[model samples]
Target: MAAQSKIPQATAKRLPLYYRFLNNLQVQGKSRVSSKELSEAVKVDSATIRRDFSYFGALGKKGYGYNVEYLLGFFRKTLDQDETTYVALIGVGNLGTAFLHYNFTKNNNTRIEMAFDADPNKVGQEIGGVPVYHIDDLEERINHVQAAILTVPGAEAQTITERLMESGITGILNFTPARITVPEEVRVHHIDLAVELQSLIYFMKHYPLEIE
Candidate 1:
């Protein structure tokens, strides 16, 4: 835990991307890979990749580069891939329904254990193998779930977030436009698709990125 805490947040965020690419390399029967190779595959610069790997001392050799299987095993342990993380969905709208149909556990060890909705028609119905319950049961049924996906309307985001925090939610992936407040210790990742799309378009028009 102490070691993990010391890693830079930016590097920590990139670890999974590196792990995924390494996993693909192993699947393709590739044994050794250079940082330059990884840079191209994952779209990260070679120098940045070297620096990120430096956080964990001696991950690769000076001349021999990296061993695909060895690096894969190392990242599996570092990312706690052995254990599956349970999550709860707090809405049953269009976006939330699509998320249910997607099998996240196929790539990462994260699964939506259940979903909650205010609509009586959605409640008691199962979508994508995940059971949907009434929103009133949030506290009673959310026990043991570590994280949540907040897909409710912007109006209900704060209310649902308060309820989720009360039930011991550690983190939230908030999809609502409203910025819900949370305690200092609680982590929240806000992903507004509209805002992201606009930002992407603006960057492309104003600052064109060079193609590799």
Candidate 2:
């Protein structure tokens, strides 16, 4: 694996997509796959897939394409698939509860080991086999967690984010629409569902398909 700093952020983000497709190919008893095949499967352009793979230097041959087993092995090591990443979920609202139940079941490497909620009724209860604790124990319970999923109300996003940072949470997957601020050391990825839906509608309106 190349130094992560050398890979473009966009390309780095697509690695998981490639790894997933390769896993599917392997499961289907496919030994090799071309960039075009991978592109079609992952919905990424072939040229873009080639460039992304180029960052890792000769991941596939010109004619032979990529071996499913080899590519999967490479990505498994690169993505640290064997290692488990413990994540904490904040706020056990509807969205948070859904996350706890689903819990990235396909991705074996990541798991929401525990969750936090402000509602007293939900506290000390277990959902989807994950124990829920009070928000007051955020710092104490999150000591071993590397990342967190923030699904609290927009008003509480910033305050809870600060508490998460104070507890040494370096990465946050924020589902709230608050756009909370964080220091350089902390990384936050926002998943604004409304914004995404709006963008999808915009694309549908402006780039409507042409029926043949």
Candidate 3:
């Protein structure tokens, strides 16, 4: 595998999609797949898929396409699929509770091991098998956590983000609308659901497809 730093960020993000499709192919008893087939399955263009695979230096043969089991094995190692990633969730509100309940069940590598909330009523209780601790115990409880999911109110987002940084949380999946600031060492991925919906509507209005 090539150094991940050499891969384009967009391409890096699509690797999991490719891996998942390959997994499906393997389960379906399909041994090989072409870039065109992969493109249709993952909704990515064939040329782009080929370019992404080329970053790893000849993952597929020109005439034979790609072997499903081999591609899955390669990506399993690349994505560290065998290792587990523990994540903490902050703010057990509606959105936070939903996260705890779903908890990335499809992905075996990632899980929300614990959750934190300010509400005393919810504290010390378990939701969807994940224990919820008080926000005050965040730093102590998050010592072993590598990442966090921020679902707190927009007003509390920055303050809680600072606390998460202080607790040595390197990655954050921010669900709050607030654009919290972070140091260069820390990574944050914001999922503004409302904004995403609005963007979807905008695209639907302006980029309508013509079906013949």
Candidate 4:
């Protein structure tokens, strides 16, 4: 596996997509795959896929294509699928609860092991088999975990992020609109639903289509 810091963020983001398609190919008993095949399955251009693979050095021959099993093993190690990544949820609201219930089961590498909330009714309870601890225990519980998915309100985003930093959290998947800064070593991935919705609407508005 290449140093994560050395790999470009764009390439890092596409690794999961490549892994998913490769897994499917492996299940189908595919011995090898071409860049074009991966491109089609992942909706990335063949040239782009090839470029991403180049970052890790030549993975396949020009005519032979990529060996499914070889690529699978390489990526499994690259993405750390062989090891489990425990995650904590900072909010146990509706969206947070939904996340806990589903919990990315499709990706066995990751799991939400615990959740935190201020609601008395929700505290000291377990949702989707993950214990819900009080917010005051955020630092303590999160210290036991490596990463977290932040669903707290925007106003509290920075505060919680600071606390998480203090507690030794290394990665954060922030769902809030707020952009909380951290040390360069700490990775924070933001998923703003409102912005995504707006982007979708903007695209559809300009490219309207009629139902057949």
Candidate 5:
């Protein structure tokens, strides 16, 4: 079956984890993998892995397993690793600075090409090879990139996102607290690190589960 046919939001989010694990398997010279092995690596239940893989159609036999190289190729094609996604940064604060330095270039497909900030001191500066421009140049600078990472203050997220959409940005990785809205064609992925860490701590405190 076509991968898109089983594109649930939750399952879509898990694709990265699957891809990472599969990549590791390939590097380790693993020829095949099982749902239980994937579950253990990603910390998800085996049944969940099986169900998730089902969307892509029978990936394994009842007793055998999935060919690691086959799954790697499938996910690479699904995630569109063939094309590079240029991303812009909307803020140059601490977290944003960190993102610029360790930008997702290790993945090879995603990269930060430019940055925008309102601070005069930060403008005209280069962070981790990406040049920063004044927010006033947002529309103009962002027009050169297809995606963005928004780490501006909470109050500025919506306004920045609106400008991003107007500038033709097709995807966003939002780190601010605000849930900015965009047209159907644009995709937004919010990463509230604080909230996620808090949730993880809460689970560890109250609902610890065995690794197995």
Candidate 6:
């Protein structure tokens, strides 16, 4: 088996999806599951599932399949389900407000512990039980939180990103249209809603699926 660091990033990205489905099976009193069954449930081909599991050694038997409880325990450890990771939200506008109101407690280890915004009216308020602080106080109040959600306007995204990196934030979920720059150690995931919607429409139009 390969070390965790050696696992392909594409395979690692699908780990959470596999974990969630296995969790559901366990709750339904399923004691074991076959690779084919897992493929159907997760929509990944059985061959790809087999290859993904191979990276972590023999997870499932040839005929007996995989033990639900054992697989769940493995995934819990791999995904760090026992420990809680606190995060900060860096905007409080409509999009950011929706994130704060979102319930992230279900099967997730990360929590939004605090928020930041430049608006004086929104400062010192608590939305979804998470406290909001002035953006100027970011470095002072961020504490041990290492990840942040960037929902600030496009113009402010890059400036706030640099500040966040300097203030010890290593990972960012950037929801803004701006393409922020960061050092090699810093990781940023951009989620552009408009572009994604446009891509979906384009794919449906050009690569239409055949019906049975």
TM-score of each: 0.95, 0.94, 0.93, 0.88, 0.86, 0.94
In order, what lDDT does every prediction score? 0.90, 0.89, 0.89, 0.86, 0.85, 0.90
2 or 4, which is superior by TM-score?
2
Model 6 segments beyond 4 Å from truth? 1-3
Alpha-carbon shift of residue 11 in model 4 (angstroms): 1.9
Model 4 accuracy (lDDT, Cα): 0.86
TM-score of 3: 0.93
Question: Per-residue alpha-carbon lDDT of model 3 for 22-100, expressed as tens digits?
Answer: 8888878999999989999899999999999888664678778987777777678778787888899999999999999
Residues 60-134 of candidate 6: C-alpha lDDT, one tens digit per residue: 888988888887887777777778888999999999999999988766688999999999999999999999999
Please list the Cα RMSD from the true structure of every candidate, rounded to 1 decimal place.
1.5, 1.7, 1.7, 2.8, 2.7, 1.9
Clashes of 6: 0
TM-score of candidate 1 on Cα atoms, chains taken together:
0.95
The alpha-carbon deviation from the true structure for residue 28 of candidate 5, after best TM-score superposition, in angstroms, is: 2.1
- Alpha-carbon shift of residue 8 in model 2 (angstroms): 1.4
lDDT for each residue of candidate 2 in 43-161, tens digit (9 for 90 to 100): 99999998888876646787889878877776787888878889999999999999999948585589999999999999999999999999999888888899999999999999999
lDDT measured at residue 87 in model 3 versus the true structure, 0 to 100 = 96
In candidate 2, where is summed lDDT lowest over 10 consecutive residues?
Answer: 1-10
Candidate 1, residues 139-159, lDDT tens digits: the string is 999999999999999999999
Lowest lDDT sum, 10 consecutive residues, model 5, at 1-10
- Lowest summed lDDT over 10 consecutive residues: which window, candidate 1? 1-10
Q: Which rank order by lDDT, best down to worst?
A: 1, 6, 2, 3, 4, 5
- Expressed as tens digits, the lDDT of each residue in 85-198 for candidate 5 is 788998999999999999486654888988889999999999999999999987766666888899999999988888888889899989998898899999998999999999
Task: State, as a TM-score between 0 and 1, how close model 5 is to the true structure.
Answer: 0.86
